[model samples]
Target: MPETKKFLYVNRKAPYGTIYAQEALEVVLIGAAFEQDVSLAFLDDGVYQITKGQNTKEVSMKNFSLTYKALGDYDVNKIYVEQESLDARGLTLDDLLPLAWEDEDDDWAKKDSIKVVSAAEMAKIMEQSDIVFSF
Candidate 1:
């Protein structure tokens, strides 16, 4: 069997007004589909991507924030949000969506996937990843 490599998708942009955020999400799902070990890091404006109550109708863009909920189904549950970024934006973990995954080993018990970490911790996570995709 081939060794599984840890893939980290780093999002540093806002959800709208650009394509970086959306493209990154699509790639993440694709990577997960290939059975790769996937992890997501949200920092800077990227934290806004998973926030709750997003209204993009005025912008005439499809609201893709809800697509994040499907990550758990792809077995991509490791989502890390940077605390400094959230604090700078005057937001908290409560502002983000409730993303969770089911643990098959634990009889399919639901578990929270979003983790709030310090900037230093996020850096360590990036360093630990075998491949890092910045968007």
Candidate 2:
């Protein structure tokens, strides 16, 4: 029997003022519901999804940043981001949500398998996935 496609959803937008982040999170939640091996890659402005301590109230938007924190509850922990993208925006992993796996061991930096890819390297990761969706 053919294998179920290993799914990947790539987000390339910022969290606020756009629905891409919310929509991508929805896909992650839904995919986890089905017990699929789902991984999410944040690129470009999408890294903002994991940016720490966002306050949406100023704009009257609900705190959607909290929604990202819930990904662990849904077992959507394979979160990845582009290193260069984060650097371009002057963000580091320290400025964003820590890996959920680190919660169990407190060795997040060691266990962090979040792929930090360049634009060229990102293409290779995309080629590796059986199914890839972009937003």
Candidate 3:
């Protein structure tokens, strides 16, 4: 059998200010189709990408916050939120949307999908990954 490579996508910018977040998400979605082990780390302002209650109506932009939710259906369920990043912005886990995925090992039982970790821990995850993509 072929070895499965692990991919870590690091997002460090706010979701809407630039195209990076959207583009990165597009890449992740595309990559997920390949069935490689994939994970996403939301750091710095990137934490806002998964935040709940985003209003982009005034900006005339499509609100893609819910796009992250679709990742679960694609089996891209490993999402990491950096605690330090949230703390630095005066935010908490409550500020973000609750994301979950079906547990394939448990007869499709729904499981909380986001994992909260520290910056140091995120670094370790990056180090352990076979490929790391940062935006």
List the candidate numbers ranked by lDDT, top first.
1, 3, 2
- Candidate RMSDs in Å, in order, are 1.0, 3.3, 1.3
Candidates' lDDT values, in order?
Answer: 0.94, 0.76, 0.92
Over the stretch 25-101, how does candidate 1's per-residue lDDT look in tens digits?
99998888778788999999999899999988888998999999999999999999999999999999999999999
lDDT of 3 by residue, 39-102 (tens): 9999999998999999899999988888888899999889999999999999999999988899
**Candidate 2 Cα errors over 4 Å, as ranges:** 102-115
Q: Which pairs clash inside model 3? A: none
Q: Count the backbone clashes (under 3 Å) in each candidate.
A: 0, 0, 0
* Superposition TM-score, candidate 2 onto the true structure: 0.81
Q: What is the TM-score of each candidate against the true structure?
A: 0.96, 0.81, 0.95
lDDT value for candidate 2? 0.76
Write candidate 2's Cα lDDT for 1-135 as tens digits: 466667889888887778878877777777787777778888898888878888877798777677776777666677778888998999887888765533455643344545566777777777888888887
Q: Which of 1 and 3 is the better model by lDDT?
A: 1
